[model samples]
Target chain A: MSDLTQLTISQARAKLRGKEITATEITEAYLSAIDRANPALNAYVAVTGDKARDMAKASDARLVKGEGGALEGIPLGIKDLFGTEGVHTQACSHVLDGFKPRYESTVTSNLWADGAVMLGKLNMDEFAMGSSNETSYYGPVINPWRRSRLDTVVMPTTHQGDGGFVSAGGTRTARSLDNAQLVPGGSSGGSATAVSAFLCAGATATDTGGSIRQPAAFTGTVGIKPTYGRCSRWGIVAFASSLDQAGPIARDVRDAAILLKSMASVDPKDTTSVDRPVPDYEAVIGKPIKGMKVGIPREYRVDGMPEEIEALWQKGIAWLKDAGAEIVDISLPHTKYALPAYYIVAPAEASSNLARYDGVRYGLRVPGKDIVDMYEKTRAAGFGREVKRRIMIGTYVLSAGYYDAYYLQAQKVRNLIKRDFETVFAAGVDVILTPATPSAAFGIADEDMAADPVKMYLNDIFTVTVNMAGLPGIAVPAGLDAKGLPLGLQLIGRPFDEETLFQTAAVIEQAAGTFQPEKWW
Target chain B: MSVDLQTVKRVARLARIAVSEEDAKRMTGELNAILGFVEQLNEVDVSGVEPMTSVTPMEMKKRQDVVTDGGKAADIVANAPATEENFFLVPKVVE
Candidate 1:
């Protein structure tokens, strides 16, 4: 009866099954919402209006026949990174230049098999590089959240008799001309943005470094980067083979758990995909986390971190303690080496993984005198600045003479980082606790960090280590910042032990409460 | 450890990515900054530490040498930017 746009996947599934609300109604609600908000948010790069209605119509027929699947009639946004048959499945890079995939990615195919209706492809950082979505050749997806101007003293530039700072008359984060915009964290930014803005129920996303978690944290959505091999890399575009993993960015922890269950499966194609059965992660969630050892890694308490973030971390620790989970201060000494090692390892692997876009088999191609000239010309025209920077860095690190010093040494440090997590986990630390990011969502106008590459790289400080160790991590929106933006607390778990992560994340969710932006988009 | 103009040119050539003279100058500064940040890794003691290629300890799963699936040349070449009769077309190399 009311607006169906904001309903979570699980909630919508129940309503659709019960016939209280038809899938068409919810799908139409989201489509109309996209019509209203997408101009400002730029979340959905392509909206499949006809496909969604057809799927919804088919789903209603299935429901009438009692032949619905797990995610029957649920509309979802597929990240551009995931291949969808006959859809515009570019990885938000100019390099891929308007090419649609003839085959579906294993992850999307799995979701479709479960009867999920497709909304459209969402935006992302180019080839899943960059923390902010700015590197996308399609342009950055502006964050829906903005710094509330209610408390700020806006200094007037006009002639004022007194030297008093004036106010801008109680402005909010509306999509007005005067309001400054913040960025939804990236490469999974569009997925996070869509979920938060109620564009789709839940969107598929992948995390190479902090892509999934950081964006979810910034947008106040829940995102989980499952254990490395939990989801297959089969048809998804690879950024870094060992580091990239697909996950769900959802409105709540339960919805994320449900999506992950269907999204994860062992495929014959991906040899690295684990053969273990997919657990009903939703069943383990909301189970009491009492007697669980939650490790508070002292290394995450980095210098120059905002006071509010430190306070939030302490609050999370206190909440866990109150819930009867033991909060112990543990040491992850090799944590400092994580970002450096990650930058090296990710780009090195990316150099090889991204080599397939050589103007040969697929995607864009520019003509030249010879094949070599064609490759150089095409790559030069195809890739964005950030993508090129990474390719060059990757080429450098993996180059002769420098390989052993940069890439090899980084790999050794990677081993030490993994050892740190293993040591803590071995000592009976069930799940580790830390701030999801150093701070809240940043203003898009703050291009100072973007200009300086390393400063932008620091945003991945707390996140890269989990990828290095190949552990599961989840970002749960705990509270809002002083600027009235959402901030999240992360829970890192042992390898393939996503059950523990879901269980613990549920506790954090229950304690800190759910967060959603004020719907400016 | 130093990456000068020649190193940038060398790597760009190696990677098959064409960079303009202006872009090369800017890229050199950016690359230098990134290298400086990663330089912190050199300070750590990684003596006797084996390089980690993957997170899991499992070795690559082997399979029997047999053609399980093939003959989908049409499907394989469907996405090609340039192709003729299922063969990807490139500039003539011998000439």
Candidate 2:
């Protein structure tokens, strides 16, 4: 049998259907990988091994009877933010530590229907706030690849004196917790880490403001943030309600496409969910990209970006150019305002959405002398410093005195950013190419916790525009940096144009070549 | 922008969160730092530009004024921390 660790969904499904492999064996392989990887990486909060095996057994039975589905027996990781019936969906916050929902999210159900096995719930940043996974109460997810020269390397952890121990395949130890090692790109960092570490084929993730794409980029994995309303948001914990959308993080474009197809469905329960027809994303698999027009957004090249990132962007352009696609230089003039506008709009919505967790309904309830005291105590103890910071900002932005000045103006700016994308797309820009992030993953300690929070927020600068515009965007591995860390190139497509984006990404994937990171972790 | 601790205290009250004076001082420092970063927005020329609302251009969908919710009240209240005989229990507000 070939390495199940490196098998794509298409290859796995084909093998499963041909009776060359059983679903149980495939799932066990992924589970074994999770067991090997999760101890050091801390990628998952829960590993549903028993349940996954049971599901895999049923899937194998179905395949034996010639009744197979697209995701038949595929192993998957669920982001903890999505409610799993009777499972802990804490969203990495202590407030909902013991809270379990009675209903499963529509997206999880859809994937299950396609025969995907739930390996377990993956960790995420608290309430999907931070760019790095350090905010997760379950702890940070370590990056998979060791720093190396080749696109893929088998290297050792860099700041090893902190606390990293020798890992599998007989790798040396690193102990750098005191120096705060680089987090697996977050708030979906756990999912990214899992896929990169070969723990699972792919995992469900949410992108409010680059939560999905940024982490994928940081981890050198492929992440796709679909058009708003492309996937149902019902049962996913609210972060910034209007901006949040569920997506997928995977090892490659093809893996992401299969996961996206299974996850994209309409649900009547979620009012924000679009009732439009779901596309067969797999149909575009292996499609030609000869006549495609790829846009290069000049605005994304922020001042002082590491020269290597700019070079990586150029390298991606050259690859696409060689693949017979026209690369057009374009401008998203309002790009500069996207971060501020997103901060305002997302918080305003969050202020209202989170109002329900005031110690009266859901979340931790602290005892106090009176009802008002109860509200105050529960929330203060339940929420962490970062979560509280966002809530306060959310409340201030939505307050009556500040509403017109902050919230209303933010709404207006939101429109401008969206219009910027629409105007460019209207002008024949099929998709936009840009750096996924300004810098590669920095050590968690390198970020001065005392420093300005806005600097931390700036990390989402390049990816936030897609969220603001309600467009589809993806991060694919472009190349590695001088330090040997992987760098990602982002592709932003027109609304509902993920098909073209995937084909273009596939072309780049073929050109830049497959990522073969040296086994570092 | 050096936000004062007093302002942090006020912001906390407005945000319905309780913070001690020490925490307020720290938060003031943090908020000021964030605001300082946000102040960079002042440099951009957004004059005469319309602000954004939703990422998608579509207006919020509206349905008929008729009530149509199908969620069962019993099921919802069943999970509440405090409930009376068929209703949610809450602190008495009006005498």
Candidate 3:
């Protein structure tokens, strides 16, 4: 009766089990929504229409037999970083041009085995490098949420160069071209955009230094980056092996909890995947955090952080305090160092991991005079400016003379940052609370961020610490900014303690009701 | 920590990615800006701190040394930019 794409995973699951609607019906609703929205949003890079329908058809049959998984019939978007087995899985980079993997990512396979239907591959920052989706060779994903209260001032497309950013599904759309779009935060921008825009019921996203949570905060959705080893990274394109973890971006914390349960697992294929039972995250949803201790780290009070963001953090503390959560002031002195450390560490690993795409195997290749020249040309042509900058930074930091100064120092700083979290958590802190981003979403490729790329890197200042500490963190849409753009509050939990985050975030979400952008698309 | 144009070239060569002279000049500034930011790590006293490799305390996992997967060369090479005889094709390495 209603547009099924707007239903949360839990809501859709109940309706499917009650036989009020079939899986095909809901999947169709999402597909139709994508058809209408994607051209403007650039949220989906590849739409697996036939595969989705086939999965839904199978799900419909299973539902009739009274057998359905937790997410049976839920149409979800998979971030392009995840290998989807014969579908596009390029990590939204041109170097990975037209390359589709023959095997599914362990996280997606886990989602599939539990009956989640893939709507398509979502776009992202190339190799999950940047804070805004602009790094994506496919162009930036337009966040559905606009700057409210303004007469629509349409600006012609500015960044349309050789990227072949084909909007409107390979055809130009007037509305998209005319509007000055705001960026969905990266590197999980498309996933956040799709989930927030109701294009997908949920999305599988990865966070290598705040990719998932930052984008979630920007788009006003719930995103949780599970503990580093909680989800097997076997098939998810490797970024930073130590910091990268797969997570879910969904309409609400409950849906994030449900999706995360199905996405996390132990796998022998990945040596780093934790050998432990994946907890039932939904079981703790809505549970009272009566005696929970929430820590507010004094160190997170960085210079130049907006007055509104600080107010939001204080308001989040008040909400939890009202809900019986004990608010305690704590300090993570190494918090300021997390971003610099993450930059050094993430790219260092990215350079090593991305070296695999040297024209010898897969993706784009530009021929040259000889093998050495060919490698140089292929990578030069394949990678975008952001990717190249990172590769250069990574190579420079890990160079023979600079290894200790940059790479090793970053690793040491990482240890200190992790120690700060461990010290706080050891003080009986149940969870730590902070603003998700310095501010709400900015306009795509805004002059400020583009002038200095580090301005973009500063977007992850709050969220990157979670990755550095190897802890589970969730961003809950707390309220709106002065401009009516959604702002999120992040809750950081102990290692493998996602249940606490889910329960705590639910309280924050309850006090601060869910938000969705006006359907301008 | 300031990156020079020559250093950018050396690193680009090391990374095996072609950097045009002009782009290399641009990269020198960007790379220096990033490095200048990362130089803040020098402020922390990490004298005794071990450079952490693994976030979770786990040893290197080992399995029985055996062929877990093979015979999927057809599928594996499906994504190759160029291939011949089921192997990825590249420019000739030997003269």
Candidate 4:
């Protein structure tokens, strides 16, 4: 029982199958842990304890009868962005706070079919916009790591901050002077924090840009953003529709592999979801990447990357080199254009996708004197500042006058960025390696985002390239920074070649060793 | 490159979100900074090169032209914020 909390999804399933532990027991333990820790972490936005208990009890019954699902008895937290039938599926925004759905998302339905027990929905940025979870209507999630008490307050600063903050949770009150609170990373911060703290074995996360991967890196976990349309985006709350893909965030590569297999499926409900065959991802785990070609994209070198991150990246290269994988120095010359292209293209799509949230259709609505007033008042109050900024930018780019200059030019540049990968893959590059984020997690109140918006956007420089090229990118925790916060190495793969990506990432994982949660899990 | 705060307010209105005047000023500076960061693209020599839109050159997959649907129009309409007699209700846009 003491060790059950630390077991990965695969280990838990093995134990459950052997009858060493009942599903009921596992579910109960997780519920209790949630009760104990969730108050301080603020990871979950909603807990379906009654529903999970019922499901777990049935799974236990089935296991007793010699019928078991692959992931039967495993408790998992789902991001609130995924629509769940008969459950509130708010995207952690005030607009959709009370909105419940009549149907479940395709991803949730797929996970259910795999016999995963629903723990609850985790919190996220308002419509998945901010890098930090502070923009979430639910409030900022506290990191689970215990650090020496520092003299600080957790406030959203102008630029990003590195120091931890004060927790509004009772644990903070009880041990107020004992531990320091750090940023939990976002917009999938809750998912990252929850998994890191062992609230659940894994969680469902969506990435439009780097929402899933960046948070995973920041929180010291493994998160994979599969190729666009690899996982159906049917039930995901739309951010930038073409860019949004739901994937798994877990403790290790194997867990992520298992969860991704369970979540990917073809659905007629979503026109964009591919009808390709879901691979047996478990079979692909731990494969040797010897003799494989890994590309080190020459363009990812920014002007002032910290020496520590640069060293860790070199260390990863050393490990891969030792494993007999050939590291090719490749050039993604169009890399510089990726961020600009993404900013234009993502906003254009987002502007169109987010138009549905008008006062007339769905999500939030505020009554006003007239229809125009209603639309104005509802949107004016419903969306957050970042969302508004993005929407404005998106609309501006896609507008008639500026369309060619911003949107069309961006699309043209997007193709060039995509070509960078195409040329590399054509030249025998299997996977591309880069830093997950420009730097490690910064403090929530370190800088005013209002003042330095570009510095804030620069955080996604290493990430947005993959999205622009529509390739799979996974972020695995590589090492710690000068301030002791975790940094991550990102691996980008050719479309639909996740097996190579996973195998190569495992090689890095083998070298770096499994992420040992220092007091979080 | 200097964007007026009034334009920021207009953009905010079009985006359907509220932005404080202070936020507008901050966003202008930030937007300018981002534009400056993106300006590095001009240094790359990509003359006569076709911009790549997708990593894989696979064309969009074809589907049957026959119409198919979940037939849950009623359920979808039920979820709409404003509906009237099985139709999505909107403010009359026609003059």
Q: Which stretches of candidate 3 lie over 4 Å from their true place?
A: A150-179
Candidate 2 CAPRI category? medium
Look at candidate 3 and tell me the lDDT of residue A446: 96
TM-score of chain B of 1: 0.93
Docking class of 4: acceptable
The positional error of residue A340 in candidate 2, measured at the CA in angstroms, is 1.5
In angstroms, how far off is A430's CA in candidate 4? 1.6
DockQ for candidate 2, please give it: 0.49
Give the residue spans of candidate 1 off by over 4 A: A151-178
Question: What tens digits encode model 2's per-residue C-alpha lDDT throughout A1-521?
Answer: 77786887778888889999888998999888888778888999999899899999999999999988889988899999998887778898877757778789999999989998899999898889888887777777777755432233346535545576644453433422222356777789999988888888889999999999988888888999999989999999998877899999988888899899999997777777787888887688678877678888888889989999999999999988887888888888879888987777776677677667766655677877666767777778877788888787777667667676677776767777787888888988888889999988877655474266777788899999888888899999888787667789899999888998798888878877556544544
Query: Weakest 10 consecutive residues, lDDT, candidate 3 chain A?
Result: A169-178
Residue-level lDDT tens digits of model 1 in A1-521: 78898788888999999988887898899899999999999998899999999999998889878898899999999999998888887799888876777788899999988989999999999999988898887788988887774443434445445876545454334322227788899899999999998899999999988999999999999999999999988889999998999999998899999999999998888988988899999999879889999999999989999999999999999988988998888999999999999889989988898899999988899999999999999999999888888989999999878899999999999999999999999999999999999989887746788679898888889999999989999999999877788999999999999999889888889988888777665
The candidate, 3 or 4, that scores higher on TM-score is 3
CA displacement after TM-score superposition, residue A240 of candidate 4 (Å): 1.2
- Compared with the true structure, all predictions reach lDDT values of 0.90, 0.81, 0.90, 0.80
Worst 10 residues of 1 chain A by lDDT: A169-178
lDDT for model 3 comes to 0.90
How accurate locally is residue A114 in candidate 3, as Cα lDDT from 0 to 100? 89
Q: Share of real contacts kept by model 3? A: 0.91
TM-score winner between candidates 2 and 3:
3
lDDT of 4 by residue, A1-521 (tens): 47577899989989999999988888888899999888888999899999999999989988999888878889999998999987878889876746788788989998887788999989898888877887888888876653333344443334335655543432221222334576766789899988988899999998878888998988889999999878888878898876788989999888999999999987667666776898887787677778888899777888998887788889989988999989899998877777777777777787787777766645678877667767777877877767766777887666567665666566667777787788989998888888899877776655665466666667778888888778899999887664557778999998988887788888888888765546643
Residue range A1-521, candidate 3, lDDT tens digits: 87788788888999999999999999999999999989899999999999999999999989999989888888999999999898998999888988888888889998889888989999999999888899898989999888755344444455556886643333332322225578899999999999999999999999988899999999999999999899999988888888899999999999999999999999998998998998898899888988899999998888998899999999999999999989999999998899999899988998999999898788888999999899999999999999999989998888899898888988988899999999988889999999999989889869988889899999999999989989999999999987778899999999899999999999999999999887889
lDDT of model number 2: 0.81
The numbered model that scores best in lDDT is: 3
